[model samples]
Target: MAHANDAELYAQWLELLGWLDAEASARGLSFEKVADFPDYIYRMERPYDLPTTVMSVGVNSAGQPLMIAGVSPRHAQLKGVSLRLMGGSKHWHLHAGTRGLLEGKRPFTRERLAQLLDGAVRGQA
Candidate 1:
């Protein structure tokens, strides 16, 4: 299968981020962009003293686009797990890493985003 070009990957990344933002808003959570450039990072937090979670897009060793999500502070390192873009005709589906073993691969959607955020908030992903 052909790998997606830089432009294609960037577009998909933006789409995924947008989905995340919308889902977060629907849940009444605070979502903010924390970084851009080398990686696009976002933080989602709930009211009160609930745990915060971070989501980031970064290139893997193979130069493929992937997204990482986990509890704040330790998010980037602890999980180190990511959802990689599955190229070819089906460009919207993201292949999960170790977590995929349980959940399997699925397109980035409101339910999927919610599951990820829930795991991150609980520090289980």
Candidate 2:
């Protein structure tokens, strides 16, 4: 697929947010969209040490998540939406049709995001 334009990227971000919301709702978790940043924060309750789950849309060096790098195909191919593990610094990339952060799972839909979130909340992957 071609690299998505900023508008398209933003649309995808919104779609991902919708998925995350549905997932969080199902799990009785809290999901909030961060206006200042192209990210969402999921708050986990007690008994779980992970107080917050921050999932940020992967942005380019310009700090624009909605940008499609015109100069680097590398960035286009490798970049996508991403989420980090709670209390961990590394981020895992999420491609629409490929296996994502969770082993053997693809985040091709919003439901998958929720599934990944569930796994994350359960301390899996």
Best candidate, TM-score: 2
Where is model 1 poorest over a 10-residue stretch in terms of lDDT?
A: 71-80
Which segments of candidate 2 are over 4 A away from where they belong? 35-79, 95-107
Q: What TM-score, computed on C-alpha atoms, does each candidate reach?
A: 0.41, 0.50
Per lDDT, the best of the predicted structures is: 2
Q: How accurate locally is residue 93 in candidate 1, as Cα lDDT from 0 to 100?
A: 35
Q: In model 1, state the lDDT of residue 89.
A: 24
Prediction 2 TM-score vs. true: 0.50
- Residue pairs clashing in model 2 are none
Per-residue lDDT of candidate 2, residues 1-125 (tens digit): 43444334444555666566566667666554333231222223434221123324222222322111111122254445556554445445544332222222533555555555666556564
Per-residue CA lDDT of model 1 for 61-122, tens digit only, reads 23332223321123232222244332322112343332221133443455766675554444
lDDT of each: 0.39, 0.42
